[model samples]
Target: MRLLVIEDEAPMRTALVETLKAEGYRVLAAEDGISGLELACTEPFDLALLDVMMPGLDGFALCRELRKRGKTMPVLMLTAKGQVDDRVEGLDSGADDYLVKPFSLRELLARVRALLRRKEREHALGNELSIGDAVIDFGRNMLHRNHKDQPISSKEAGMLRLLASHPGETVSREKFLDVVWGYNAYPSTRTVDNFIAALRTKLEKDPSKPVHLITVRGVGYRLEP
Candidate 1:
């Protein structure tokens, strides 16, 4: 899974990043709310760990803005404040969960797993999808192919899900930018190209002559079953 950690304290941020990485999650970090908001809105992440106290924007405001833009990815608010009202306010601001400072890493991981499980359950009820040889078990956030398991990163899985939902139809570049990247920032087309290349490499029988994922000359891409 990919996670974004938004915390200003250098020590805390470093520790969180290292711990999450050790747990096998790809992580991105931002020092303040502005950068956090930017990364949250521009990058593909399965979840966000946001510190409520920070310079400029603050986690509450950032969470609100993300909700306003219809971003429903899970958010866990972290703060030194440990009051009932504070936790209520964090949830009201769109956080899926709240964590008090000095929290055990074990508890944090547990909450993350819970939230992802909930999301997967919700996704399963909405669509049944397949990409290449992999059948997506959205309720489990898992992909199964042949008798072996293909370990896919969360971002890659999200991209594949989108493609699978519209098999045989072209998915626009702008749609990918808005959905996968999340915000209005202009990343080079190369970014999309690179991800597609990576996806093809992992999922295709012949990466050089992909059968399921095809590039449209001047448009975007189409997935052929």
Candidate 2:
């Protein structure tokens, strides 16, 4: 699973990153709300850990903006204010859950697991996805073609999941950068192109004339199946 932590405190953010990494999750982080909002909107994270107070675009505003943009990812708001009104406000603003400051790491992890489990259950009934001869087992993160398992890198698996989620819909270059790379720090679009090439090589019968993963010139890429 992938998670994004939007905390302004360096120590807290680092600790959260390390903890989540230890739990086998791919984590991306930002120091301020602006960057956090950007990452949340562009990335395909399973959940977001947003600190309520920050330099720009506080958590409430960020949550509202994400909802406005049609993002449905689970958002857990972290706040120093533990009062009833603050919790109500956070939920009213669109946070799926709220975590008060000085929380136990174990509690946080439990909440994270619960939220991700809910998301998985929701998406479990979606249509089966296929690219070329490969069938993607999302729940298992295993790809099978002709009853044979194929080895795929974590990055490649992430990319495939994103593309498969929106089959036949063009995913923008910026979206790929944020989600697949886990941050918006890449200096060029070449990275996306390279990954697309690699994906085609693995999932297409003819990489030169891909039928499933198609590129839209001057735009981005799309998957047909």
Candidate 3:
């Protein structure tokens, strides 16, 4: 599979490129967040490894931008911070997972494999789907509307695809968190709510008065699209 490695540290960048290539992956590397964002936006990659700290456009902002642009590939954030808030920020910014710095290559490879397997399961659900005026390309994790296109994170695609698969059905919040974020995601159902808000903004004609994505009050949400 293809992978993107975005690290500012020269030695770390080279090591990642070499290690991933040795493991039979097609690799792309960038030294800064700007160049990384450009490559990530234009390239087709199965996964990405992004550094948290950088000279400009830090990883958090870059990750948010990735979601806004609709690139839904799994991201494994690399950070030296190792703080609870930092990890929370990474996940909240749409990163699929993270590895604290000074990690073993074995652990990194294992995590990468796990994420790829998860994506494989998600992509098997569907490919092209329509909601309102938006056409979703699940294979590429992008949203196509009118003449414009934006990338979507894999989590968003999986959740939306799940809802679309069950048209007019109200899937519960627990189901959403369990199925999408898995068993041990961060506490609080607010995570699911946040994702729902993001989806409303993208798929609904009016986010404030969502039509295609309607919340079922005490239950969860239903997709009429």
Candidate 4:
């Protein structure tokens, strides 16, 4: 896989590049966020490792810009700040995960592997999905059912993709929050249920008693298909 490492610190940048290379990944490194942003926009990368604090542009702004420009690769933000607010800001800015400074290389690598695995699952799901009588075209953010094309929100698509990624496995509310809404951003787990209900209405023949999207009482949910 191709990985982009954007770090202002020379040692950290070199170490990351070397380590990733050792693990058989093609890597590109940038000294600052400006060059990082340039490379990110111009190149095709499977993942990005961004430093939160940089001279030209901070990681938060860079990530936001990447999303605005339609780059959908998983972004892992590296930062010295480990505060809850800092983590929240990083995720809210479009980062898929955050790693604080002084972290072990092992943990960092683990996070990278996890993100890549998630991406692979998403790719496996492809751009189109068939649910009951409905067909979802994720590439165009549209769902066609009953001879009508209905728009699906990105959040809805994300939640469905996450559940679809793990068919028959129960996905907890906490997991949904962490992946779909960012970690601990929403105050209530009911938010996940609400979105699930919306998805059921669209995908299930009977929303009241959903068969494909099954809810585990006192637990979470699982997708049969």
Write down the RMSD of candidate 1 (Cα, Å).
15.2
Candidate topping TM-score? 4
Model 2 segments beyond 4 Å from truth? 125-225
Give every collision pair in model 2: none
What TM-score does each of the candidates earn? 0.56, 0.56, 0.63, 0.85
Superior by TM-score: candidate 1 or candidate 2 = 1
Question: Model 4, 43: alpha-carbon shift in Å?
Answer: 1.8
Q: What is each predicted model's overall lDDT from 0 to 1?
A: 0.77, 0.79, 0.85, 0.89
| Model 3 collision count | 7
Clashes of each: 0, 0, 7, 0
Candidate 4 worst ten-residue window by lDDT: 178-187
Cα lDDT over the full model 4:
0.89
Superposed on all Cα atoms, the candidates' RMSDs to the truth, in angstroms, are 15.2, 14.9, 6.4, 2.5
Q: Write the per-residue lDDT of candidate 2 for residues 1-225, one digit (tens) a residue.
A: 899999999999999999999999999999998998788777798899999989878999988888778777878888898776777677667676788889999989988887786567547635345776888665455678777877665456657777766767898888776555433434677778888898787778889999988899988999887
Candidate 2's error at 153, in angstroms?
39
Ranking by TM-score: 4, 3, 1, 2
Q: What's the lDDT for residue 209 in model 2?
A: 93
